[model samples]
Target: MNEMKTDTIETIKRVLAEVRKNPDLAAAMTPSTDIVNDIGLDSLQMITFILSLEDAFSLEIDFETFDFDHLASIAKLSDYIAGRMKEHV
Candidate 1:
């Protein structure tokens, strides 16, 4: 089944919580929120977040071509994920 972008966003929130568990996350979250800058994820946490997203979506991220620019914002990441998921399907 194809997942909606909203589902992707929600999954991101869940995965982020698992990785960071930031108390202010809910209040800080927005489509424009920068995944890296806003969340302040360390290198390890960032990797964990990516892996968790891959697992949650049941799709492997193409690190060979993955653009770190996608990490610039929540909307960008969500869009990239949705595109990747489509490719997987």
Candidate 2:
């Protein structure tokens, strides 16, 4: 894989770790977990999680352009982040 893909994977792992720090939240997450339904992440928590991910990756996500509901699974989230990062390159 290329560096961008590697970075995307790392960012996803980091986001998962941050989300998993909460016991109640951690129990619901899996690679295929749905952020909204399975994890029960509220809007505030979702924003916070995305901000944390942005800080960790040093990338800006156009929040206005994103559909939060689609960011359900880790793979989907990773793909989104990767796409955003590519735009900055």
Candidate 3:
């Protein structure tokens, strides 16, 4: 049920908009926007975002050794998710 199979950025944005409860942020977000620092996703929101993202993208995130490195920005997160999705496929 991947809504945007090859468009993880948009998919991520859609998920973020839902998690943030702010539709305007989706429109305002660029690939360069920092999700952690700028978007200010706290612990609970981050958990919700991760869960929602896994559901939305239909994949599980390996949190065993996962770091917040991917959360640095949207583009990086998109790249990470795209890579992870590829691995999932």
Candidate 4:
């Protein structure tokens, strides 16, 4: 894969590691894993997860521009991050 894609995947895994306390939830996380339905993350957990992601990537999340649906999957999250990164560049 290209560098950006590689970086996104690694970042996703690292963020998930920090946010997902349950081993089962972490283990079930794939590219298509749904953060709410599949991982069962509550609002507080979701906030922590997003905060972890923001810290991991050194970027501030603009909730207004961010799509809630993108949080559903690792791939989508990566894409969202990538898109946000592009905006800063």
Candidate 5:
């Protein structure tokens, strides 16, 4: 994979680890899980997780350009992050 894809995957893994650290949240997650439906994250938790991801990856997500609800799967999240990082560059 390319550097951006690698970075995106790493970011996703880090975010997953964060979710797994929260005992209440961990039980609901899997690598292929959907953050919203399967994990049952509310809007606040979702924003918090996104912020954590932004910090971890050193990327600024343009909220105006993002459709947050679509960030359900790791692949989608990775793609979004990769796109945002590309915009920053």
Candidate 6:
């Protein structure tokens, strides 16, 4: 994979490690792992997940501008975070 993809995956893993209860699940996470459906984050957990992501990346996620689809999988989240990080840069 490219450097950006590799970096993003690492960031996602770090963020997941902070918020997720299961180390096995976090370790098993791949580009295709669905954050909501596969990980089964309830509404509250999703909030915590988002907060952790924002803190981990030092990002201010504008919920109004967010596309929920980006939260579907680890790949999507990585892409979304990368894009947002670029925008801030």
Assess each prediction's global lDDT (C-alpha) against the native.
0.84, 0.69, 0.84, 0.76, 0.69, 0.81
TM-scores, all candidates, are 0.88, 0.69, 0.87, 0.81, 0.70, 0.87
- Candidate 3: tens digits of C-alpha lDDT, residues 1-89: 25453378887888888899998888898888889989898899999999998998898888863578899888888878777888878
Cα TM-score of candidate 3:
0.87
Writing each residue's lDDT as its tens digit, candidate 4 over 1-89 gives 67887778766766666676654444556778766677667788788988888888888888898887987777888888888889888
- Candidate 5, TM-score vs. the true structure? 0.70
Q: Write the per-residue lDDT of candidate 5 for residues 30-70, one digit (tens) a residue.
A: 44667666666667767778788878879877879888554
Candidate 3 segments exceeding 4 Å error: 1-6
In candidate 6, which residue ranges exceed 4 Å CA deviation?
none
Error of 6 at 82 (Å): 0.7
Off by over 4 Å in 2: 1-10, 23-28
Clashes of each: 0, 0, 0, 0, 0, 0
- In candidate 6 the C-alpha lDDT for residue 89 amounts to 98
Report how far residue 88 has shifted in candidate 2, in Å.
Answer: 0.8
TM-score of 2: 0.69
lDDT tens digits, residue span 1-89, model 1: 23587777777877787789775575558777788888889999999999999999999999886898999987789899988988978
For model 4 the TM-score comes to 0.81
Give me the displacement of residue 44 in model 3, in angstroms. Answer: 0.7
